[model samples]
Target chain A: MFHIYCPYCEEHREEEEFHPKGQAHIARPEEPEACSDEEWGDYLFFRDNPRGIHHELWVHAVGCRKFFNITRHTVSYAILETYKMGELPRFTAEFPEGSLSEKVTTEAEAMSRQEGVKA
Target chain B: MSNLVAQNIRTFETHPGVEISAESPLVFFHQRSGAPAPCTESRVALRERALLGHLILRGGAIVLDEAVHSVLGFGLPAYPNALSRDEGGERSIQWLSPDEWLLIVPGGEEFGLEGKLREALGDAHYAIVNVSGGQTLLELEGEAARELLMKSTPYDVHPDNFPVGKGVTTVFAKANLILRRPTETRWELVLRRSFADYLYRWILDAGEAYAIGVEV
Candidate 1:
């Protein structure tokens, strides 16, 4: 079984504690009404099945119960990296080593998204 | 249900009066399967810390932490998957996620605690959900307790990996529960009421070799 690393939990947990949530970084159109039918449909249904490097969304269902992104090799089945939501992936298709300019998610900025929001 | 409304949230006491009785999820299991009493040769002992007030706090940890610290007189666990306990050890807070923490206290204190936390958090982006009736805590102790846990969960239970004061929600015998090491000799399993029977049986079966006992 794959011992996947959960970005939120900050530890590697058993695969049974997690579930793959399809492709990652699929942003919802900022204004849905302005989008064309094809754009909306593609956003709703289409997903990439890249054979090489792929970024996927996954939830640590049983552990932290948090959603995070995972960059993995689809063919080799090796996990390249795990990152929390709202943060960009380092080992994308182009930059295998990592990108120099990545947004540093601070504790305050992360908490700002939660302000005034009731859960 | 109490008509007390705090911060537009309805609050009620699960334990209102002495007339209404409370039972652990294992009550049925004990009736059907029968809990074997601990003997001199028993190397494992199981005890249910039933009806503890369990709260799931969600939001920015900083806001929740301050509220919790003010209300409970203790702050949230400093790191992920860590457990922080009160001086008496009767109360604990476990870091479940970056934005979430699980607070467990004495059985009847939940209602009051929720009110205090809500009062402290006024308009802050936070949620304090009292999930007291949904789950229960089972504690395992003795020599073979680690062996019983090893058979059930894939997570490394060695002291090096899971030291004292660390708690994690993890898979156990096909089910998921909060696994915690509160102290060196004790391991706490916070099981959902729905999964308690199956896990109880699984623990009993796995611990049979070491002669496990149940303290009803």
Candidate 2:
């Protein structure tokens, strides 16, 4: 079984403490009444089934019972990083080949971008 | 009923005021399976701390900490997987999640404590759930107690991983319980009332080789 680092607990806990909750960052439509039937159906039922880098939502069911996101390599089963909700991931499909240092740089850039938008 | 209706939050005392026969969760197990008497040869000992007050506190840490400190004279455990106890050790608060904590106090004191906490935290977004009858605390001691736990849970029970004051809710055998280390030689299992018998049986079955006993 895989050991996962729970972002809230700040520790590596056994896999049994966590439950995989499909894809991460799927936002519900703000105006569902305005959307077409097909668009509504897509929002409700459609999810990415990718073989490479995947972002997943997981709940630490037994430990902290908090929901968080995991950026993982599906094929390699390597958890590149784990982050809390409302936080952006450093390693996405765009930076799939990014090294640890590259991830740090991008993470800083993402933080600055968020601040820029806020400002 | 009118007073309760006027209040936004509901709180109840599980313990009856009149003296009534109360059975611990392990009563059936102790009766049928029979507990071994603690002896010098016994490497592990188990005892149930029954009928204690179990309160689940849910709120922001700062607010809860302020109320707890004012009422209970202690603050909540600041770190995750940590437990903080009063100087006497009879009262304790264990961190369950970011917004949740478990406060356990001596029997017969919970109702008043809940009222005091509610008064201390007026109009704050918080909840206090009294769950005294729903669960019981079982204390395991002796040298082999840790070994008995290792056999049951996937959690790393080694002292290096589970140092004193660390507690976690984890799988125990096929069930779930809160495992905690209160002292160097003692471990506590907060077992649900329903699964206490099964867990007791599992512990006995696993600890047979170690000559485990029960201290009445």
Candidate 3:
């Protein structure tokens, strides 16, 4: 039940309007023919499962239908920021302290407890 | 005349010139479900604005705005999720995306409008898709219209969040449709030809408590 800010629509829309695309900032190799087998495999299958600060690609499926980036904390489920395509995220793993990590950790713990109860 | 304007772009009139009977998207629904008469007890009234011209215009906002203004006498909406209508409100242009807008006009006016827009736009990159047959507009009004919409869509229909002159493509029930607030009391739903029946039934089910009626 997350309310995500769509950069294109310039409003916070319900989560149902959005579809989360995998990891963000994963650029394709310029020359696929030049890459080795391992490099190509990594490009195709590898994705970071960072615990603190994670960037994700999401599309406003029901709204503007445009793709954008979201800087979210995995545990807390707090979306620190959402930016349009071709934009960079302000919060990154290197700057974990700047993100809402502490608050999200508590929220994540509470959410897990709720999930456990429901289960 | 349109052929000379842009060979790469394809534009066509969606309506036929013959006198054959045409049915709106809701014809079957109205016939099957039977419309309840509009009365003081009916809190919501649904009506179909059938056979209207619906065009999906894709291009740079500035270029499309200039061309639309030159042809339709009204520019594209300036902001996202905003709708601009003619003084008479018979024609409207709504911003669907950064580069996409929906232009709706009275039936029989779309083909000429598209041609004129092509001529006005010339070589600028653009696309005008006539979706008149692919979709239809349903007008919902009365006191319970907003509540009916809130039940169908997850998007907030509160007057504060969805003010007049705003439109958005959103999930409605199990389907997706375009929802617009044209006035304080009236809301419009643009449903695809395939999903109209499902949505109409869903609306009726949701509006039953309010004594919803279909105004044919």
Candidate 4:
């Protein structure tokens, strides 16, 4: 089982102790009042697909009851970092810099994995 | 007080465990005299206290790290899921979500610490909240402490998993807190203020077979 890092517990607990919250590092649009419908739709629906390090949000639902960000790799299912909900995750070139790219990669991989499972 | 319903809970009259009493704030419970006590105040033989001081430190790790190191004489842990502490282990700082941590100091030092952290952090966007009154502490000792914790919490309390100096904020029954094993024979349960009663009842009922008794 993957050892998941709980930001609230401040410890890497057995994966059973946590629940994945989804793609992490989401930022609300600046000046939403000035955005077009297409912009809003893209903001709501778009995501990135990557093969390596990704950022995602998770909640320690059974632990601290707090939301936090995590830097994880989809292939190895390895987590690089866990931070609070509102904070920006420190990023490196090896890892996609923000939520948008990470989300795109995550969705693409998830779909491919689902298809593989089906096949 | 008049209209509140009395909670019915099962309590043990005898148990093979250490009895820790409140001698003072920040005092350690001796293993020699550690035993659970029989209390009538709330039908809780072993009252799980919401103890000590709880402060949430929020800010950039680099900036907050400097502040914590300078002000508290300890550093904010760099790794996720890690706990940083003072020499005595009396005070501990645990990573509580990125850009945030939970610092447990002596019972009365929260306000001062918060002010100091703010000063040390300067204009960094950070937040520190004092939650001492909102929680109580319960010290569970004796051989049965670990087993009892397994019953109360889903997280593994095994020494292999939760070695001494390690602390976590995990689910306990229906609530949560900063759970730590500061001493070899002791387990500290930092509980919230409002849920103290419910947790007490749960512990007494679960610890019944162990003959758990409260000291103070």
What are the candidates' interface root-mean-square deviations?
Answer: 0.7, 1.0, 0.7, 4.0
Give one digit per residue, the lDDT tens place, for model 1 in B1-216: 223344378777777587868888888888886888999999999989988999999999889889888988999998999999999999999998888899999998998888888788877888888888889999999989998999999999999999999999999998889999999999999999999999989998998998899987
| Model 3, span A1-119: residue lDDT tens | 56889999999898999999999877688799999999999999999998878999999998899999999999998888887766445677876655465765575467556543111
Ten residues in sequence with the least summed lDDT for candidate 1 chain B: B1-10
* TM-score for candidate 1: 0.91
Clashing pairs in 2: none
DockQ of 1: 0.82
For model 3, how does the per-residue alpha-carbon lDDT over B1-216 read when each residue is reduced to its tens digit? 556675676555567768866678878977876877777899999888999999999989889989888887889888999999999999999989998999999999999888888898888898889999889999999998988887888898999999999999989999999999988899999999999999988988899989988887
- Cα displacement (Å) at residue B127, model 1: 1.0
Residue pairs with clashing backbones, model 3: A76-A104
TM-score of each: 0.91, 0.91, 0.90, 0.60
Q: Lowest summed-lDDT stretch of 10 residues in model 1 chain A?
A: A110-119
Candidates sorted by DockQ, descending order?
A: 1, 2, 3, 4
Tens-place lDDT digits, model 2, residues B49-128? 98999999999999999999999999999899999999999999999888999999998899999988888888788888
Docking class of 1: high
How do the candidates score on chain B by TM-score? 0.95, 0.95, 0.95, 0.73
Candidate 2 residue-wise lDDT, A11-111, digit = tens: 89889878999999787887999999999999999999898899999998887888999999989989999988766777889888654666676765686
